[model samples]
Target chain A: MERIEIGHGSGGKLTRDLIEGLFLKYFKSPELHSLQDATYLPGFEKIAMTTDSFVVQPIFFPGGDIGKLSVAGTVNDLTVSGSVPKFISVSFIIEEGFPISDLERIVSSISKTAESAGVKIVTGDTKVVEKGKCDGIYINTTGIGDVKRELSPKFVKPGDVVIVTGFIGDHGISISLSREEFEVETEIKSDCAPLNSLLVPLFDVPGLRFMRDPTRGGLATVLVELSETSGLGVRIYEDRIPVRDEVRFICDMLGYDPLYLANEGKAVVVVDRKDADRTLEILKSHPLGKNSQVIGEVTEEKGVVLVTSVGGMRRLELLEEDPLPRIC
Target chain B: MERIEIGHGSGGKLTRDLIEGLFLKYFKSPELHSLQDATYLPGFEKIAMTTDSFVVQPIFFPGGDIGKLSVAGTVNDLTVSGSVPKFISVSFIIEEGFPISDLERIVSSISKTAESAGVKIVTGDTKVVEKGKCDGIYINTTGIGDVKRELSPKFVKPGDVVIVTGFIGDHGISISLSREEFEVETEIKSDCAPLNSLLVPLFDVPGLRFMRDPTRGGLATVLVELSETSGLGVRIYEDRIPVRDEVRFICDMLGYDPLYLANEGKAVVVVDRKDADRTLEILKSHPLGKNSQVIGEVTEEKGVVLVTSVGGMRRLELLEEDPLPRIC
Candidate 1:
């Protein structure tokens, strides 16, 4: 019943109480309480570090909230970089008058996600602004992961095949509806989740070339980046890429390309043709990736081209403008 | 003549353009473009990691802007934790209609500060939200530093000397007046500079026990925390503590305790009495620590006690409420 007051982020007694009663209670660890400005991570020789600031509007949406999105987003970022997430630092900017209950729920979600991903919440900070100065809460999660191998476009080749883990655009569409700006409704849920467990199995595939979570610019953007960075072209079979009917319907109504919509829980993997079937099988075995499919292949050409269902070809260029701002 | 649009944060073409044109133009480095979701930090066996979100109002202030504060703040956090600040990840949440010029200025400041502090801006993220949903901008910086030695409360003991780097309350007073909420005005400027250079010397002192940048809750709050955490008492002579005349004058008029005001560029160091003189000498040699003074000592009792200017004793308790929010 104790709602969050401005004092709770004051770096004073109330802030300490909130951290101890809520954060410490959930994220109990020795390094977390090292009583230093920064937590020490020992034996991290070659580590992958990434940072993301999640500012999704409405805070919560179908299947996930900002807390879950934050954890999954950073973890996926690290996982795609060929590292298993080991530690994370979660910092929050809470608006005054925000409900403590909501914060508790968010923290609980973070704990569950971090636990599932086998990452420790190591060090963090919280700051509160006056009411109306900020929305509800914006979380910045920076994670450090243990690198098992180096993954980069430098390793991507012309004969690699692209695999998408499950349906795309669910997160973007779900969050868009949650905002209620369009007055439209759907049963679509966000695909927000950590792909580390699902990805661990695919690392064993010797032909694995590239992996990336198409979060912000979705599948097309990732392909474009891959093409541009690695100087290789891509050809995707549009009919092969999975899109939930509800998501496709919403996109059609809005005239939005599903390829450009953000996805929180999906990954686009590029592997050699020889290992494509095995990679797809590994992804399909995971509950979150049951809809996995081989969607495309890398080409010697210099741009991303999509083949239509009727055998027509369309160019999937980089996203030019913002259709959604707070979709993440 | 260009301004930042919502598309620039959409993580699409415009976003990519912004990164290449603005961010990469200034923060260009190899690690930044490693083309991985996360940058790999090699040879970091023992490192310290910390994160902070800076929402300082009026992004540009007298002595520093949000960008400089972002870099310096994170660097100081890592520095005080006994680490040589090395790499940083900068994340920004900008309002859609924010001026591109202001952002350029902020980024320019960040580049200079990071360069001076001997740290690299390795990874980053940018998110744009609709205007009015957020203030002009908020920056979150997470840093990784190499830990040369362990710094903790367990190292503190009775008879340790408490030394303050320089004048207290300068940053708080300067920012308070910058808001122009109070009618009164003064010439106080923010003491906002990176203290890593000033601190490297003290690390060599055999008796050095603890060091912290007295930021949000200021000197009193830090003393209370050190006392509580170490299970040792702190006694400071009020007369020996340094406060600029303008800062003290403003504090007097506003009925604010200078001890409780923030100091962005100052440090509170505790060292064994045997090495107190040597530490003080080293600190005073640095420009940022020219006014360093030994104002307090650790005691056998277990709470913070302040010696009044009138030969009286006053108990300094933990900060109860926020006198000012978003000061840094």
Candidate 2:
């Protein structure tokens, strides 16, 4: 029955109680306990920083809520960038009159996700806007990590092979069905998760050229970027790219392309051809990567081309328009 | 006439163009120029981190806009915490169809502010929500700085002097008048500014115990917090507290307490009583601190007390409700 009031974000007594009763109880870090203006941390030799804002609609999706997505999204960005995420700062913008119980639930999710990812929630801020000024809730998480290695397009060569950590388009499809706008029913759950555990170990592996999360623009967009940045071509096999039958079915029914749909928990990695099989074996050994596949390879040409099962070639371009909004 | 489309946030070609054409052009830094998933920076021995989300309405207001406020808010937090801010990460959540021209103007403001604050915009993210799902725009800024000194209540002691850098409640009054809900008009402007260049020098001054920006809950809440946290009493003179006549007139008309109102560009500093005069002189030497005053002194008693001009005593409590929202 408890509801948030404007005072909860007024940086006053109510704000203090909410932080102590909810956030402090959930995110138990020594740095946060100090409640200083800024969290002071011991610095590393080199650090990586990234930021993301999650405005996912239908806050509670099949496999994840906005809290989980917020943490996972920032952690995955650090992970794919060849860093070990160590700290995260979370800021929330909530609408007035939102349920305190729901906020607690989201806070719990953020705590669990950060724990699983081995990152600490060190500092944060909260603001409340009057009704209709904002959506239910939006979370912005900024992550800092220790840079373990340097990964860049310059290291990617023509003979490098492209590997996707797991099936693509599940997240995008799951979100679509969750909206229930199309009256379509399916049991596909979002692949929303942190990639630090699955991808951080690969930083030590030899021949890792570059890695990036296939998020908003999906696998095809990542490949196109890789090609353009490295000035090398990419040739992806349409059949080799793993897409779940349920997801593909939903995409087909909704006139969507699985290749350009978003994925929350997958990574597109480019590795030297000589180490491609080793990388695949290492990836498949992990539970989150059980469905991993080597979907394509770098080429001498200068554009992204798909080799279809019909023995025809088609070029893929960066997505021009959005089919879905606020999908994380 | 150009406006943002849903496609601009799709992480596609449009997204690339926006980043390259708009963001990159303004936020010029080597780390950002690399266009990696995360920004890599050389680490310091110790660092301070903070985050804040700005949901200020009207987008633009007298003296500053959301962009300036976003950068200054985070930078000031670091400066008050005894750090030299070095980098900032900006993230935007914009509603679809928001004017690109307005966005560019905001970006220019951010660029200028960051440049003046001597911090680099190292990394960022953007998301666009459907119409009616959000206000025009919201910004979140996270800052990382090198810790130059340790400022905490643990170092605060009885007999310390409390100094407010300038006037209070200007930002709160300015925002209220700009809303025009009461149709009151005035030339008052929001005192939204970055305080790094002004306050960072004080870190070298001896006897500086603690400092904090009197932001959302104003000087009263901050003093109450200091009293509670340090287990020391504070007795401030009402006559010494700086309040502009224009701001006071509006507050009197609106039934608002200026002490509980917000300030965007001020700091409440605690210093050893012996060094109070020297600190005041130093503060008065700066343009931003010409109105600096020794407002009160730390006491042996355990609560905040106000000595009224009429020789009566009054007590100040932590703000219980928000008189204004989104003032920053």
Candidate 3:
């Protein structure tokens, strides 16, 4: 098997060959084809920019690999921020001796994911480290998008409704099980799809106040952050929150709180009570959001409180320690 | 010493504390203060985008650290492309148990370097891996710059002059010596400085055709690339190439070619013969470019050639292997 060598990252002939033969072939865009130090993008009035680094273990997962996750992760960030992602820049730090075939597979995944997310791979960089200096590969992606709408927690009001786009905690649960630390296995895969298309239509709805992807710290963390930042209160209903049975079972067995687990492709959206039903209708119309549900509402109280099915109120605090690392 | 824990990158309370306590304190900007998923930048007609991942070993070197090198590396790429760097996104993949003090020092260096480069650190992400899965830290910076001038190898032509901004191979040599593998000692320091202020002036100079920073593959590699890409010949005189006495001494002892070693703070420029003197004068006026020299000229023949001090003609090839890795 062909393995990467230090020369492949030396920015020399080997680097050139790898780029031209592998990356350029997969990421076919005029901006990248020019092979300049920087890619020039023309005509932008207002832009949104976000970045993320993916160091998830087990490069390949059930539903997605690091390549797909990296692209979707940034795209989802921009999407939640009410931006239309346009171009993305990817950089990689690969360990020497990493398989060339694995790299090609990842590159192909990146291309396909970027295409589906409706973004162009404009520029990128690659660096290789000595064998033990790095894990197999770590990818960093920065996305640029056109600001389509202004979304902020400041717009959230006491009577606003909170809606989750899909079943929560699937991604976190899938990664945990993939580690094989527990002998339990299930068919649940990560919900690591890009939410851009599903959520873009919601930007047209009136009273759309704020949006956030429940990624690393999950739905509860995002709600807590929203409550603190907006200086408002949140009241979520435990029974209304959507979670797959398998995820809930695994979380229960592992002593994890599904509400605090990560979700790669779901968004916690706040909209006016008057437009909540309309927003839900729009979200539920998309396949990615078919499991959408109104889970909570903004309140005059000051903290994030979950009203359980048994009529008990529990306060949700920001996560103090990680239950899982590199779940993204 | 306080050390980074996996919780610090969990995107929860600990992550928030780290961001607010360190990154936000240093990277003071309204865009970052918003803490939105993405930063919004208004009013851009044309922009240049570039990304790079820095994994330089030793973390700290004589003149700069990985933090400083990361910022300067991306900023210089934009500068050479004739852009005014305006916004930068930084992401770090850190190892668990890495010293927080070291991380803070690196961040301080990054903040200082970004400020000096006239760019805003608008958005970022942090991910931590298990202790042995990664080196101390790796930084990925993607920059967005306003395009002030169009530059390309397509504009280069025969009879154009090639100018180098300063001494070659300082960064590579400094890194090699820092490794302590050769039992050598020297006062040499890496020339890891941002070149925007120095090179931005040349953008206004008429007849300037192309510019590229001689970095990973160094001056010879850059010149060879220029020759191949522009379909023009390049003939550089060894006598005209600038090299410090210490650098020359180290290279001779180590059996390394200074021409192929990396430089962090220098640019190889191609310009019209009629404006060569003016370009040289302008470059010489800057402290960073005091050692600037017109070392070669574009020729009608097809390959890169070196005219040795003894008047022997020798061809230069693109570097096939790196003499030093992670020199940044």
TM-score winner: 3
In model 3, which runs have C-alpha deviations exceeding 4 angstroms?
A181-183, B181-183
Against the native chain B, each candidate's TM-score is: 0.98, 0.98, 0.98
Which rank order by TM-score, best down to worst? 3, 2, 1
Please report how far candidate 3 places residue B246 from its true position, in Å. 0.8
Model 3 chain A worst lDDT run, 10 consecutive residues: A177-186
Candidate 1 lDDT, B88-112, residue by residue in tens = 9999998878999999999999999
DockQ versus reference, model 2: 0.83
In model 2, which residue pairs have backbone atoms overlapping below 3 Å?
none
User: Which CAPRI category fits model 2?
Assistant: high
* CAPRI accuracy category, model 3: high
DockQ pick, better of 2 and 3:
3
Which regions of candidate 2 are displaced past 4 Å? A181-185, B181-185
Question: Could you tell which candidate, 2 or 3, scores higher by TM-score?
Answer: 3
| Candidate 3: clashing pairs of residues | none
